[model samples]
Target: MADTNKQSSEKKEYHKKATGNALTTVKNHSKENDLKLYGSCFCPFVQRVWISLEVKQIPYQYIEVDPYKKPDLLLQINPRGLVPALRHGDWGCYESTVLMEYLEDLSEGQSLLPPQPKTRAHSRLWSDHINRHIIPSFYRFLQEQDQQKQVTLADELKTEIGKIVDVADPTGPFFLGAGISFVDIQMAPWVVRLNRVLKPYRGWPEPEPDSRWAKWVKAIEENEHVRATTSTDELYLDSYERYAENRPNTSQVANSVNSGRGLP
Candidate 1:
């Protein structure tokens, strides 16, 4: 209880400080300015912006926020209480998929959105599909407590995930081709977790990342900007454990429904 209280207090303080800083900075911000990304380790969506910023070689201030208890400033900027919110100059934006488009406008490097209208439309189509279909599927597994249900979800998830990858990735390594595209940034975070989860969990088969995605991720990950987010594998593992610990004993919730009774 003490630890929880301390953590909550710190979040409150961070929120206060962040708000004061955001208004002053936004009031006098300019283009090509330093970027600020408020994100959670658990949010794959935020990871999208992280990858975009890295690929664009843009420097950003990364602020970690708690999804359970968000800071006031974060809520002030994004009332929806979403992760991966970004503040660029006076403009504050939320939603991981949308942030990809914003990154393209801020920095120039490889084009994330295709130049041609037809091709760009195709790109957006697949991008939206993953968020709509693929992400929810992950939640199904995340919520599962019974190993049997988890296995079922995992199997279905693997098949569906493969289709999403196979269909979206054209002939190139990157979803957009020769280089990493907005699709790459949008999908990479979830891909990393999906691939990692499959390796250790019995529910899913080992992942076979598309040739292009594998190569593109390697190259993009090597960039100086991307390196900041990449850390020892142990760090990622600790984060996963912390998330599980934070959740209200989901197993208990599942069992409550299992005992011929519903969650109360």
Candidate 2:
């Protein structure tokens, strides 16, 4: 019990500096809340759960954990020491998407999944597609140094992002419809990060003008939930820069300008 108390004190100290430049801090929610999230501000995966909590109006204690310096408590909850682990009372959950669904199940507010069964299934499918195909392909594209390979990667990423437009609802602002769904929460972090960080410096392509992707981007940017959950643009870019430098073979493109380059 004494050891546990000591660790809790250490985590609190770490959180003071680890909140980074996020627009939302622990202060946004009350300390008495039983729901606690262990994560860093810089992680987009973490942002997904954070956005869900805000959108659902679920009060959770946000505990910032440095991903690089895995704390004992974080490790105890998730053996991998990954960020975005959630603890409600004595129960714990890991993985951002899993925790998002768990939180949705536990809380009362806007349904993260769509009401229609088919649409909800589709939402789950899109989330899976993003995790399996889009993220990996885009990261690989950014890390590629060879000119021909970079071109190939750029095309791959363009095709993948275009898929989101193809799958998005034609009648409205979000991926599902008028309301933000689980799919939207899953995709928003990467979309926002890419637009702010990669689009300007690395020449990542924007969805075509007047297209569904364009509309979605505008709507997401205007979303109150997204606005509240997201960090400042300066901090977002700065964190991504640092991340690129840290990830192996990913630094070259992040460091270079895309002026007159083949990247699109």
Candidate 3:
């Protein structure tokens, strides 16, 4: 009970708006529009959708929301009160991956998913792998306090990542070769944070140079959409301190990790 209360208090006190490049992007999209994205800069899930909107060149208004506060408009769009909620005209939708697919269907921009059915299905399969395996392992490793457990959790994460690498195109960067696709956007946000948040706090090591992991990391780090949506490194480090310390928090991801309910 005390831990929950502490976490609730911290949520109210955390940074409430975007910083650095993300803030600039927010300003650019501040005008009212029928297409809107309710998001918090600190959230990787929100970043996923943000990157998609940029890649697809969809015009949208950015409405920053504090998830803990559960503003009325946010609740109307998503009763769960999560960010990355999409308000299209009178209707709305939430869930990062769902919104990604929704944007792909609604837009005429460069396709994020493959044209062929088989390849598209393959992409979706790996995306599921990322969500079900890689992501949960990431949180578990980040929150683990015991050194021995951390090592085990780290290995689990690496192994899951390796599965994706094995199946990814062997030619150049990005999951499906030179072009960034749904798979790339799906995993990019976490990849962005791995070095910044995980390495310093969890002692997560850098991938070997010239390796596929290294190449892919470089690609995501350099991607224009990823860069535009990301905030300063210091901001991410500060925002994720509670997760690194394994503090009891009401964050959906953190709560999912604690309760073994999978990500919300």
Candidate 2 lDDT, 1-264, residue by residue in tens: 999898645431212232323544556653766889887776778889988988888778888777657798898888877777998899887999889989778758778986788887898888988887777666666555576877887888778878877878897689978988898888888888788767754787776798788888888878877776667666666566543433442223332322323211
Give candidate 3's TM-score: 0.94
Each prediction's whole-model lDDT (CA): 0.59, 0.73, 0.90
Q: Residue-wise lDDT of candidate 1 within 177-239, one digit each (tens)? A: 666776666666656665444344333443346564455555555444334444444444444
What lDDT does candidate 2 reach at residue 160?
Answer: 85
Clashes of each: 1, 0, 0
User: Candidate 2, which segments miss by more than 4 Å at Cα?
Assistant: 1-21, 242-264
Winner of 1 and 3 under TM-score: 3
Error of 1 at 129 (Å): 1.4
Q: What overall lDDT, based on C-alpha atoms, would model 1 receive against the true structure?
A: 0.59
The predicted structure with the larger lDDT, 2 or 3, is 3
Q: Model 3, which residues run further than 4 Å from truth?
A: 1-13
Mind giving the per-residue lDDT tens digits that candidate 3 earns over 1-264? Answer: 999898767652346788888999999999999999999888888999999999999899999999888899999999998888999999999999999999999856878998899999999999999999999999999988899999999999999999999999997698999988999999999998898889988988898899998999999999999999998888778788888878776488888998888888
lDDT of 2: 0.73
Query: Ten residues in a row with the worst lDDT in model 2?
Result: 12-21
Return the TM-score for each candidate structure. 0.70, 0.82, 0.94
- Candidate 1: regions farther than 4 A off: 1-34, 201-203, 208-228, 242-246, 249-264
Model 2's number of clashes is: 0
* Each prediction's RMSD to truth: 8.0, 9.6, 3.1
